[model samples]
Target: MPSEAPPTDFSVARIHETVLQMLGAGVLPPVVQAGHPVLRQAAALFDGQLNAEELGQLIHLMRSVMRRAPGVGLAAPQLGIPLQVAVLEDEFDVDPEAAAVRGREPLPFFAMLNPHVRPSGTASVAFYEGCLSVNGLQAAVARPENVEVDFTAPDGTRQQRSFSGWQARIVQHETDHLHGILYLDRAELRSLSNNAEYSARWAQPDIGRARQELGFLPG
Candidate 1:
């Protein structure tokens, strides 16, 4: 008789267990990874479905989870919510030169609901980006350096803001999630690298060098 096939691994079950653990701890919802159906569907508009109090509570929970993840930004889709919402924050604490080079600066925490963005200028920049949903992989993506966004604030106020550099990139990345887009979909596939390989070979943010070494198009 043929040898028995190797036992099937249940890695997805382990992922579900981790998600349950996070939920049990009263933390934010577990991040849904790539290939999840929810991540691929366009998120619905918030409209008036949630009252101010309900919206506030949701934003608070999202903010808490974002801080716990220690990420610069998080989107509703990442948390398995199909609503157009996101939170972002940044404290520019890197080397002064690096900060200047990347246009990194301190950003107060903010929430965006039903956000939409338009390119503010023709200039574009390419940098390696990783996503919480698409864990353990990074790739170079070219995006407009500046964008103007119209969005609703957490307190039920309409706001429009212009963002550039790293902030612009963060906003674009998160907003894409609302529209069922992933950074990997826009990335230069030739530049894809595992997280460990990225740290070892392309940790520094040098777009030109990355293009040259990784066989990607210039920004």
Candidate 2:
């Protein structure tokens, strides 16, 4: 007789239950909101203050929290860490047409530490953007479509690369967090909408209509 198959379904359900228990118990650090002082202060560079092992553990925790939030990106300050670190990944599955319109593509998970970005070109695009820190609000903000960034990895390796489209936006957004800049600072105030309203009215990626109807600045 063949050996019995492993109880895969039971294991999976047990893991899910464990996760819910952890969440309810607040085992995860709370994501700091917009008004938190850490979100408004420039984060310090890693500079080897923490040992490599410690830094690795912190990065792992940050990545886990980001995934649990179901967000594409997270910055250290967003978690009140006050270190120049961030992690981002995109599934690019929200809406194919919307993703294409925004030039978003699936990106594997990556971490950036002490990153700096430079615009690759003068051209910029405006889109409705939301932030985990800001919570529930979205607005139109213009940002360069291309950028080159230099950053240190968790392993202390320096790397430089260019990104375009939604990837560039993600890099820029997370980098800004290191400098204590929130998306709302760059957003058109009149374009602000609650997440519910944005889903109901502005979910289609219409920059022109958003500007006209929502009083967003022209891209």
Q: 82-104 in candidate 2: lDDT tens per residue?
A: 67789999974667778888889
What are the lDDT figures for the candidates, one per model? 0.79, 0.79
Worst 10 residues of 1 by lDDT: 1-10
Clashes of each: 0, 0
Worst 10 residues of 2 by lDDT: 1-10
Question: 157 in model 1: Cα distance from truth in Å?
Answer: 1.4
What is the alpha-carbon RMSD of candidate 2 to the true structure? Answer: 13.3
Clashes of 2: 0
User: Candidate 2 — which residues are off by over 4 angstroms?
Assistant: 1-26
TM-score of each: 0.85, 0.86
